[model samples]
Target chain A: MAIDAVIPFKPKNPKTRLSCVMEQEERETFARAMLADVIAASCEGGCSPRLLCTAPYLHPTAEVCVDADGLNESLNRVLSAASSPLLIIMGDLPLADGAAIRRLVSTEADMGIVPGRGGGTNAIFLRHPGRFRADYYGASFLKHMAIADEAGLSVEVIDSFRLHTDVDEKEDLVEVLIHGRGEARRCLQSLGFVLSVEGGRVGVERRTHKETL
Target chain B: MAIDAVIPFKPKNPKTRLSCVMEQEERETFARAMLADVIAASCEGGCSPRLLCTAPYLHPTAEVCVDADGLNESLNRVLSAASSPLLIIMGDLPLADGAAIRRLVSTEADMGIVPGRGGGTNAIFLRHPGRFRADYYGASFLKHMAIADEAGLSVEVIDSFRLHTDVDEKEDLVEVLIHGRGEARRCLQSLGFVLSVEGGRVGVERRTHKETL
Candidate 1:
């Protein structure tokens, strides 16, 4: 059976942390490119991709489910109704590819999780979806582990560089440019973003400045 | 200056979880082999390996610091007195290699952590050891993150499979057999341990069981 992959995305005000380097409109476009990459990866990994968007939106590849509620509430609704195994992958992980998705879903455990850079959960694979609930926010990775333990479910943490690297800040753009192989990289490159090395540190530098009014 | 790699190990009654699969003496030998692998990796990664054992022990390639006062206390003692960057890697991660260690210490953040399969912290690279303390045990990964946040330290979580996979159970031996290139793997294979596939699940089976009394 094909696992259901629920990708929760905020259509409005997305990638706000990248505001220092990208304009509001560019952030939205970059976010969509990332979403597209995730959806494609999900499909290639033998799962059905469904976008749990904050607002009404359409994606050609994935099934769209709009929810006004926050990330936790929105995911809980889908999780409660899930009949089979479900995978919840954050849309911002542009570096995640088909291989990373396959590695996560192939784990032999009741629950598989990929923790993000800080304390966020980048992706989760739940065998018994009805028995678990999503509590995404600060330290959600730890919270999810506790929730699974309380429910008497076995948890396996999938540690992968591609799955854990979520593009949030401007510094995160360097990874996407270096390892990304999808629309997200093209979008960033098209926007004149280039890698800059200063004092043995790599960061993104915008080559073309947008004209101000 | 070479970074100080402090490896916290319990020399006595170590690897109690693997007792079901191995005898007391076998577990001790296995634990030592794993520790040797980690120490070698640390040295190859440009850090000075130091075993912070619960009991007195000696190694040819690394220094040994015996502190019977539990894991947290012993590690904090070293962390408090450290004048340079310090790394703490669990002794059971036999799959972790020099590249894994290099990837962790190369991070630009003040702290870099590799979370174990469960909530445990497998490896930590602390740039400012005095500003932080060691906290191992249940959910130590999250606790360390909180501690770093309180100290106003930038944290980078290095998500790597080899670093995160620690040998605690009989099933974990499969990973060492598959990906390990160290004394631990040779020790396991020498004991006639081989991968056993039962119902599409991989496990370990002792080919030559010890003669019964």
Candidate 2:
């Protein structure tokens, strides 16, 4: 009955799409805050979380598994290492809460897959070690579902917006600004980010105030 | 020698995706303001502006062409009525400016197409009335380019961020708030929308304020 959660985090050179609006130092800081928030949610959901890392920055309490390979191999390695039910969650989900994570893990299916924003797999809960291979690239949710189906595994699709909204683009920053709480919000505010309305649209604005960090 | 710019304005039910955040009255007012902004930009670009409308709201000096048909048909009707070079601009481009429009029209190709955000046509400059049909639905920029190719018309793709950013989704409201100017900004400000950072994200928070209009 032990559930181990694997959170993949790319702390080095993170949130590049947000580079259009955020400076490099701030992007890294914001990414770490999001990772911390995701890890906190996983632990709060009664799961022992593991960090699969490429960079040196480590979450204080989570067990760190360093892997230099691509996302597929690193995740696969972590999945192989687990002795019980495994959960794979993306680090960028700032709005991930305990109830959502608990719901995902508590599902009765052999596997559960959650679709990410703009065609990616956000979260997957697998009961077996090698029931299906993890293909976490473009349009991955459908691919994961198909893999689970081919293996004749019962799959549960967890349709949760908070679990799906990964911080990927400048447009995505709005979701965080409008609905996000905790570390990510504090990081953005400290960076002097403000929401502005003009030209029939909304976006983040950092005034003459530069990042002191 | 003359360039007539046709801006299609759907003043009724402007941005439905933004219904998650903004009320109906605010969305309509915002859409009308964007239409006015587009008209001003078109006029400043040395193009005679015209509004092809389904509703009764009129831009002060621009010629109003009332149409009850669908988007594709209404646009085709306006195109057929024009004798000189015709320019088609979407009413939702709040960030559109005179420079972008001037660049679009000044292109020497038989057809000039500007790509919109989330895969739609933002602006089109056509020298021939029946050269290529406008397909402004779902990834229409590529569809337009293919159409122009089949018609043996030279297509010029004008790459401008301001012209490409169409205000359609709730996420798009962030762009307007961050980088917008004039009426749209003033309107949102009066609505008491403030950027709040929480739960590791940024979001809009209204504090003790209701829409005055």
Candidate 3:
């Protein structure tokens, strides 16, 4: 059976870290672009993606589950009712492609974790959904591993650069420009963001002074 | 029993890619620092680390295995005669600390692979050694996965930024400066390399013009 992927998204005020370089609307657009990439990659990996949005939002590719509660509460609500395998991935991993998604879903363990930079749990694959619960934020990777152990579920950790590089800080935009190939990259490029090298360091620079605020 | 870690080291002409920024001797010194860091991390993770050196070199900590053959041939020679659980990790992953090593050694699967940035296997944890051979070049991550599947051994992929970020190119030095806390970072800093921003991109720059070449 096809694994169901639930991507939790904050429709309002997303990507706030990019506020120094991107306007509010631009951040929203970029967030949606990343979400689109995630959904497309999930589908390509033979899984049906469903967006767990905090607010009402429209996406043509995936199903939307609107729940205004906190992340852990809402995700557990979904988990409690899940019957088959579930893949929970963040919306900001623009570098993740079908290959990464395929590896996550193909794990034989009861639970699989793809940890993000700075001890964050970016993506998770659960064979038996209700057997595990979600607990994100602040070294959540270690917390999730503990949760799995407490539940008596066998766990596997996936060490992937593409899956772990979740776009958050403005500096992280460089990775998207370097490795991303979806609408997110186009959105950044369309906004005049280009890769620049300053004193031997690779970063992003805006060529044009057009602000959309 | 504690897992035995085998770290391959090339004593002569190592890290040639950093030749533009670092001299040959400096590269060798930096490589040794990284090796020292890896050995320390392995020991801290409760594993006995052995340095698989291309030439006879002295390490204060780990035992040395002198093998003049190429990487594949030498590692295979060791893999063919393995007894207990073994961990094969590259010496270039200086950012990998005790926690990362601990996670790698604690996996429940037959084999756990930590892949490098570009389809390279950086580390492998094998429960039953001699069952799986070592293949370490050009998309060896995927190749190892296939080999495991062919051998009917279950596999788990560990997605870790510190473990996957192997220092190969000169640009990779930035990660060492940012996240590293060992002799490798100290070596780079002692060589006058500092984090600099070029047109908004983060990179390494030499503040002092003390060329060792």
Q: What is the TM-score of chain B alone in each candidate?
A: 0.96, 0.90, 0.96
List the global CA lDDT of all models: 0.84, 0.76, 0.85
The sequence of per-residue lDDT tens digits that candidate 2 reaches over residues A106-129 is 889999877664446889999885
The most accurate candidate by lDDT is 3
- Candidate 1 CAPRI level: incorrect
| Candidate 2 structure quality by residue, lDDT tens digits, B1-213 | 448998888778878887877789989988877787788788878888888888776666888978878888888876777677899998887767787789889989998887664345789999996666776675566578888899899987665556766787655555455445656656666776655445434445555554433
lDDT of 1 by residue, A7-125 (tens): 99888789888999888999999999999889888988888998999998877768899999978988999999889999999999887778779979998999999877545688999
Q: Count the backbone clashes (under 3 Å) in each candidate.
A: 0, 32, 16
By TM-score, how accurate is candidate 3? 0.60
| lDDT head-to-head 1 vs 3, winner | 3
In model 3, the runs with Cα more than 4 Å from the true position are A209-213, B1-57, B60-163, B166-213
How much native contact recovery, as a fraction, does model 3 achieve?
0.17
- For B1-213, candidate 1 gives per-residue lDDT tens digits of 788888888877899889888889999999999998998888888888888888888777678878889788888888889888989999999977887799899999999998775456889999989999887775577679899999999998775867877888887787787667899999998888876656534567887656311
Worst lDDT 10-window in candidate 2 chain B: B194-203
Weakest ten-residue segment in model 3 chain B by summed lDDT: B195-204
